[model samples]
Target: MFFIMTISNRKKQYIETVEKNITKITQYTIFNRTFRHNDRKFHKFLVEPDLNVLVVGIGNGDLLASLNPAVGVGIDISQKMVEFAAKKYQSLNFIHHDIDNKIDILKHPIVGKQKFDVVILSDQIGLCDDIQKTFENIQALCHSNTRLIISYYTKHWEWLLKLAEAVGLKVKQPEQNLLSTTDIEKIAELSGFEVIRKEYRQFIPFPLLGLDIVFNKFFGTLPGFRRLCLRTYVVARPHQTHEKKPYSATVVIPCRNEKGNIESAIKRLPQFCDNIEIIYVEGHSKDGTWEEVLRVKEAYPDLNIKAFQQTGKGKADAVHLAFSKATGDVFMILDADLTVPPEQLPKFYQVISSGQGDFVNGTRLIYPMEDQAMRFLNFLANKTFSWLFSYLLSQRFTDTLCGTKVFLGSDYKRIMKQREFFGDFDPFGDFELIFGASKLNMKVVEVPIRYQARSYGETQISRFRHGVILLRMVVHAYKKLKFSV
Candidate 1:
């Protein structure tokens, strides 16, 4: 009973200490302001605007207000901090509750039955006595689509942070949980959350005459240097149980000069789902591919096949045209060259339909390819670009140039809406989808497919020419994704 009372008293003291220092901790010093601004910028990048956002441990409510959430709710342990935030940010809802000890936060009258699209726990997980329990408690306020962002300072910066606090450069507070990124990941898993991605930011906590921007954006983002970053974030979602459903699939085959493979493409593709629609967008093929498409459609009258002559040039244009006409729930891309066999498309369909992944990409590099499937120079280029792109996109991509990519029609529409952001620069059509998926924070999953040598068509890829284009796209992505403010 004595030990129990001591624990209860310690909790009360922690709350009181935080409540008393609310105003002081949030004071707008130049250094404090810079840190907060950088943090807000990073959070804004991770979270899309116009979302229903719930900010746990919202101190002074500045971060929540900056996000401009559609429905913003801020919760904190200290009543004084909550009251202060409520008075300042009248537009957003604020609640005072102990996340570690209290009942479901959703049980509060103000937030009843409201599920958030994004749940932010910025630097708040450290304040919880039981981080796992805190995560479990917050799950009540989330839906399957909700994205939970947890940010905290890395332990490597503890000494520097303490020195700053001692010298009055930053706010000093009670002892925190101070768990490592691995510890936090494990705790989140225990609390029924699956981590999507991890990001490290803010190598220099204070702005030092614009060097902060240069170092943080370029030098700090390097693979080795990122480990020493002051701040780390883990993006997660509620662990979901996916069951296969009867989702209709639209297989869009963008053919350029594949007359020999047109009929074979139709015959080999199995009926993977109940309602399958095959769209063939012939891109001005010199080998009579368009004529073959027409003949195949006439011959296979029972199959739901639609053929169209592409009005524009390049594979990207043809793909965009077919995607616009796609009628099924899911959209699939199968290159008419027949390098990635049409038979393996079922694996792609199952992944997307079963909710195993949001953006399913075929990886030809995983399985042993046929001897003549890929040229030596092209194979080396693919390997190099795969690693480079995976780093740039924050997702594992084994084969970036794979023609067999699958995603939902709804997601493809969302990508189309934001096409202006990246511009219609990609002629090959792969980077557009890849970049769009990364921008939308979609889970990119790769499926290994046996790459077969083309039986009829020659490889259209010009190593030197397309290699330059890929390099240009990499530069553009760095500017938009990593280097951008």
Candidate 2:
């Protein structure tokens, strides 16, 4: 009975706080404006354009409205906040429901029998009487593919927030539990959700002469300073237990001046799946590589093979062309130079088909390479950049330059749509997919592969020139992914 009474009192306090601060909450001051705007941009990045989204503790409904979801529903404990939000954004549906009272969210008819693509619990988890129970309630509203995004303030800012409230610079709130990112992840785990990505932002919440962007983008993302940030965002999805069925595969081999390996690329490949299509995207080669691709397609009439000539230069263009024409459930990239063996393609296919990962990347650094597989400087650069990218994306990546990558065709379409966020910067096509996968919050898993020396063609890579371009891409990615708005 005492526990029930305590929960009732907490609910009363939250309602009272919202009734008192409804007007003040909507009227954003410079500090609150900057903070909320920054948050909106981050959430916008986390959410795709046209998804069904549910926002818990949907305060004034500003965040939900910003996402441009196909269908948006918001639930809050405060009736006044709900009414105000409904009146403000009549297009979005808002409901007055107490999440702390162990209410099943699916019981509501408006949201009944409907699963969201993204379920957001923003800044309200700390206020819940039982965080575990709150996540359990939310579990009913999620499908396997649904992404749960939670945002909360770091506990280290408790005193500062109290000071701000004392000075009337911030809205006062009821006393609540302060949870760290780890605490939230563990709590969500108990409810059968696994965190896929985590991020820290806003070292300085207010814009102080443009230094906010500089510090938040560069300094706030660094190792020591990131933990001190004001906000933490976590993206999670429902843990999968069921096994996935096999998916047909498309291997896109982009060849340039590799006439000798055209036919072998087909013969050496293992029949990894029931249905496999091989596409030879031949760039303008002087050694009759295009003719060899045609000859190989004719020679291997038993195999499902197609050939295309690149209308534009660079590997990125060739990849985009092949992806456009690809007719398989999953897409795989194989370098024509065959540094990464064709026999290992099944490992890549198995990882994606079994739902072990969303983006399967091949890592040459994991296993010992054959002699002269990669230059010493190239090897050093790959190691250096892998660590840097892992830090940048908040996901582990061992070899960013690996020629073999696999992902579902459906996800590749979404990544292509999200490619405009980073623009056309990657000439090699690896970073394009890597950055896109990270942006889309896809689970990236690396498969170890033994690197072999190229027997037919010379390496088309220039370490100095490409290394400089890669550095530029890092800076570009930082601005897009870390420092925005």
- The candidate scoring highest on lDDT is 2
C-alpha TM-score for every candidate:
0.95, 0.95
Please give the CA lDDT of all the candidate structures: 0.84, 0.87
Candidate 2 stretches with Cα past 4 Å from truth are: 1-7, 100-104, 207-210
Counted clashes in each candidate structure: 0, 0
What does candidate 2 score in Cα RMSD to the true structure?
Answer: 2.6
lDDT of 1 by residue, 1-485 (tens): 00121234545776777766777776777787777888899888887778899898787788999899999988776677788888899999987666564354546776657889898897877767778878988888888768899999998888898898899776666677777889888999999998878888888878799988888898778788888888898888887778787899999999889999999998999989989999999987888888999999999999999999988998898998999898999999999899999999999988887777889999989888898889889899999999999888878888999989999998898777567777877888899899988777787889999999989978888889999999999998888777874
- Model 2 clashing residue pairs (backbone): none
State, as a TM-score between 0 and 1, how close model 1 is to the true structure: 0.95
Clashing pairs in 1: none
